[model samples]
Target: MKTERAKEILVQLLRIPSPSGREDRIALYIMDFLHRLDYDVHIESDGEIIDLVVNPEAELFYEVHMDTIEPRAEPFVRGNIVYGTGASDIKGGIAAILLMLEQLRKENKDLNVGIVFVSDEEKGGRGSALFMERYRPKMAIVLEPTDLEVHIAHAGNIEAYFEVDGKEAHGACPESGINAIEQTFEMLQKLKELEPFKVKGKYFDPHIGIQELICENPFYLIPGLCKGRLEARLLPEQEVEDVLDLIDPILDEYTIRHEYTEIWDGYELSEDEEIVQIAKKAMEATGLNEFGGMRSWTDAINFMYNGTKTIVFGPGNLDISHTKNERIDVRDVVKASEFLMYVNEIYGKS
Candidate 1:
């Protein structure tokens, strides 16, 4: 695969808006590209799964997502970096995957490998979860922006919604009704006391924040309802039940009601695994030495939970992901493509 062609593919993928849950357009584009290569690609009925099979007997596979965070602007490259919404978050990884596939095709050697591109990773790992439920691969390499390092661990997240119900009364009679908005603020203050929940050895304690608060009513009357959304980032060793227990003491009052939603468990890989070993070898071969930590939720957790030894590896800096300034270094993409190709070769031998 030529460097210019790789860049062109990256730009095209970035131009397509594939926000979480809406990846049909980009999925179609990917299918078309793969079909033109005469590869055996199978897409699920709902179009969320794009499976490219290089060798049916192969137990090794690579995974990437088609969806990205909402876009802020069109993609454009200035010098060695490409700027856009999903550029760094993962279109770069996708581009590298495409190029690697092309290289493998040209070699025409027997390779027991495949690539699975799924949807809904940005929201929840529904696509990955579904794939794992149906297909059983011995090991997988999940592509996410990791600046070309091998990410052996990732954190999970838990989101909860809080509601406070209050009675409404005429403004003329001030004390007759409870101001739910004020009560909500008080509740927030209590929750804030658990700030920076980090301990020395144990997985960093969850970081909590109030994501949303809504309470609107006529000034002449006290609001009857107040709603708040709370979210926490939990380390791999942490569990949602543990987080819920920690916050239970603060909700003792009868005024506040809460429920947990969007719980993602975390995972970590032992360094001695074959996947990690091959990745480290690949990094050494590629002259790269920056290992990274994926401190947020990723589909890798789904793969690991389902019994597949999985590692997250890709290009770009994750700090810019989901931000308007999201971008990736073109050189990094090229280097990642080379590294991944080497991993594939090493994997085939193993």
Candidate 2:
């Protein structure tokens, strides 16, 4: 593949802003690059998914997220580091794959492989799922920056909405209107008291963290409704339905009309599987000295849940995915591209 130019493509992707639910522009840009290479390309309107099939005969499908959290004030770099929102999270990995696709074409090396650039991976996995159902690959690799290691397992996330209600009245009659904010505080406390939300596995966090809560009309006009978004990162073995059931009582006790929606779930690749062995062999061939599972959640879990063996391996440091100072190492880009070539070849031969 064209790994030598990995840095250039990766840098270009980092400059784009493709937040969740707003990935059309970036997806089209990648589509252009893939099309120039003469590869089969298509965009799934469901999530604006941009998919590539460089070698139609290829069996393995490589996937990466094409959306960034946001853009920085100004592009800046210093000493092998570039700071921006999407650098490490995934744009870095996307660039590497794009360059590799081009390189494969330039070198006349057809590994019969395909690539998928998915949208909204930062939020719900609906984008990836849309592509997966339509184009189910035999084996899959999620492009999540993991410091060059072969990480297999990932936690899943379930996002639910809670709508709290209250009596609305004139601002003058403060006592007449029941303050919904007060009820929110009470509900939150009980939700926390449910306590000890356990997740199986060694490094998984047992308790789910509250992501954010949106409260409206807290002042001036009477406040009638308040909504809070709760996020729970579940374990691989944890049943999402069970967690939703656990929250049932808490919902009932509260004097409000609540709405719960299951956002998504997580998954893992059994250590003894064929996919795991293939990834280990590829990493060894690429001179990568490390391998493991990532603590953070990734689309890898989604594939595993679908009964497809999956692995998470890509360029950049995942720690920087959502940070203001996010950046990826240039060397990782080239290395990951080269490795992707080898992995694709292995999968194609198998």
Candidate 3:
């Protein structure tokens, strides 16, 4: 596709607001775009996901999530950079996939490939989980903002919530009450010492930290109730249950009530694997030679868990993804499209 046309599509996609459960508008837009290109497109999960079939029998699929977190900025272009919510998070990747399809159609290049535009990725990943229940491709590329690096390993994650209760005392009291907030902090410190946090890998190390903390009764008194949420990124070699087991004693010691809201195990692909080799070749062909692990959980975890060989790759910098300053270089989007097209060529032959 022409560079200007790709930029236009990127801008159009970024203008649409599709957050978590609300992805119908973007899904419809993509359906129409694929339909106009003479491809079989259909909505699944009550229009929460869109499936575009270039070849139904194809064993390879390209996947992108349609939902972003929440819009922090409107779409705009300054020079070659496009700034907007979801611009770097995923819309940029979406544009590259669309451009690749358009260019393939224009060139009349018949290749065995399919596409999935999923929703709820920013929230619970229900869209991808639902898709995996029905289809398992032989190989797949789940796109996210990776700055063109090929990721064979993706970090797993755990989101936990806990509540602690303590006795309240007046502001002038010396040691009459226990501070629940302080107790919460101590609990987290103990949990952070789990073996998973010490485990390191070639591409990524495990991370654990508190994301939210709140205390009840904000008067000039020791808080009686404290609630908090902590998130952790596990290495590929770690298991969610194993980490939890190590923290069970700590939680018990503090008498803290805890619940795990989300849990997903990490996964990795061998360097000699066919999908990895092909992706690396595609990156090299496009002048991108970096190989890194995805520090954030992605739809790739779902596909890989369901027995599909999957990797995460795309344009944009992940660091700025969810911020108001989210943006992407239009040139990077174009380069990603070119890389994907090359993958299609060589993958078809293999």
In model 2, the number of clashes is: 2
Candidate that scores best on TM-score: 3
| Clash count, one per candidate | 0, 2, 0
Least lDDT summed over 10 consecutive residues: which range in candidate 1? 195-204
Residues 178-205, candidate 1: write the lDDT tens digits: 8888777776677656633544224234
RMSD of 1: 3.2
Estimated TM-score per prediction?
0.86, 0.80, 0.94
What tens digits encode model 2's per-residue C-alpha lDDT throughout 22-52? 7777877887887787777765655245433
lDDT head-to-head 1 vs 3, winner: 3
| Candidate 3 structure quality by residue, lDDT tens digits, 1-350 | 36688789999999899888778799888888988988887556644454334454678888899999888899999978999999988999999999998899999996557788888899877888877776778899999999898988888888888888888998677299998888888888887777778767788788889889889776899888888888988887788888878876877777558888888888889989888988878877889898888999898988988899998999999989999899999999999999999999888888
Ranked by TM-score, top first = 3, 1, 2
Q: After superposition, which runs of candidate 3 have C-alpha atoms over 4 Å from their true positions?
A: 46-54
Q: Cα miss at 64, model 1 (Å)?
A: 0.6
Instruction: For each candidate in the order shown, give its overall lDDT on alpha carbons.
Output: 0.78, 0.71, 0.85
